[model samples]
Target: MASSLLKTYKKFKWLPFGNWLFSKAICKRAPYFATIKPKVTHLSSGRICAEMPNRRAVHNHIGTVHAIAQCNLAELCAGVVTDATVPNHTHRWIPKGMTVQYLKKADSDLKAQAQIPLPREWKDKEDLIVPVEVFNSDGVKVFHADITMYITEKS
Candidate 1:
């Protein structure tokens, strides 16, 4: 389950091409995520961090990073953190909803951080809110997301 996955990630993340390979696998599950070219910078039980470059592929007409692209990064961070934190044998998590705010123009590479409390128990169904913050290269907050993840026991 997630514990084993986390262990695997920890073992390989330090390898030369580990992070890139992990991102590639993630993109296979969610193809649009590949468009942003996300790179996971950190991961742990309750936290995750990732970055996306300010490339032409992610640019908006105004030359800033597109809003949806930021959202995608936020979701990616939140989902990874949730997957690592939630116990995998009994529960699985899926993004159910999100509320986002664009605080400033993101004209540079973006970094996203997501955090959630480690769940102590799982119900038949529950909604857990994971908060993610995105920062521009200058360390200014550019976007924020409160993503609601639906958790359920495996049938």
Candidate 2:
């Protein structure tokens, strides 16, 4: 199933407005994802990339992108990549916890990238760690997160 979805995404990913349409579909499932308006730049097994604009809605009092907003982007990248990598019929995953670091002020649009080595085989259940890095428009590393996802077999 994951492979099938990836194929569908790849087929349309190059079309005009394709990324936006894909993002909208994701936001529909996770409504809060709409708040940041994330645009998925890439999606493949074990890798995902997304970006969000630094706008007023996501700004902090001091005018930088809010820390939580960055966290949201990180989670979105991580979740999408995980979903693409894990076999849907055999395993499912949910975020267990996240450890985040705010390295610098996010004063511009932010891009988040997450990657993990594809597992050779799926365990019935396990804790998988997915690391996400967030960078500002200038390509400066602004935030980082290690999201732990609990993977379990579908009953």
Candidate 3:
């Protein structure tokens, strides 16, 4: 069975601006995510891609996208992918921690892609690591994050 999030994605992905609507629905549920104004371009069982504009709100003193803003994009992709991959009604997940590296200055709009392997079975609890990479519009990798999610079977 597909997760509710994945079901929502499939239902809306074919309509006009559907992906953007799906992203907004997610933000409505998790309000803090609205800060990045994310647009989820692609979402699947184990992979997701999202983008954020390089506007003044996300810029730093040097005029590059702020590091924390990049981190927010990373987390958004990671969390969504994790939710899409996990079995609905059987398991739930929360971010445990994150390790990140900023490789280059982000001067353009940024896109983030996150990937994780699908779990074959459920456990009482496990730490799943989702890896995400953010790239500039030129396709240069600018930031990377390894997000740890603590997943557990629902009671």
- Top candidate by TM-score: 3
Q: Where in model 3 is the C-alpha error above 4 Å?
A: none
- Lowest lDDT 10-residue stretch of candidate 3: 116-125
Q: Which stretches of candidate 1 lie over 4 Å from their true place?
A: none
What lDDT does the true structure give each of the candidates?
0.89, 0.89, 0.93
Assess the local accuracy of residue 116 in candidate 1 as a C-alpha lDDT between 0 and 100: 79
Q: Please give each candidate's TM-score.
A: 0.92, 0.94, 0.96
Looking at model 1, report the run of 10 residues with the lowest lDDT sum. Answer: 1-10
In candidate 1, what are the lDDT values of residues 37-73, reduced to their tens digit? 9988788888888989999999999999999999999
TM-score of 3: 0.96
- The stretch of ten residues in a row with the least summed lDDT in candidate 2 is 1-10
List the candidates ranked by lDDT, beginning with the highest.
3, 2, 1
Better of 1 and 3 by lDDT: 3
Error of 3 at 139 (Å): 0.8
Candidate 3 residue-wise lDDT, 22-93, digit = tens:
999999999988998999999999999999999999898999999999999999999999999988688899
Candidate 3 displacement at residue 151 in angstroms: 1.0
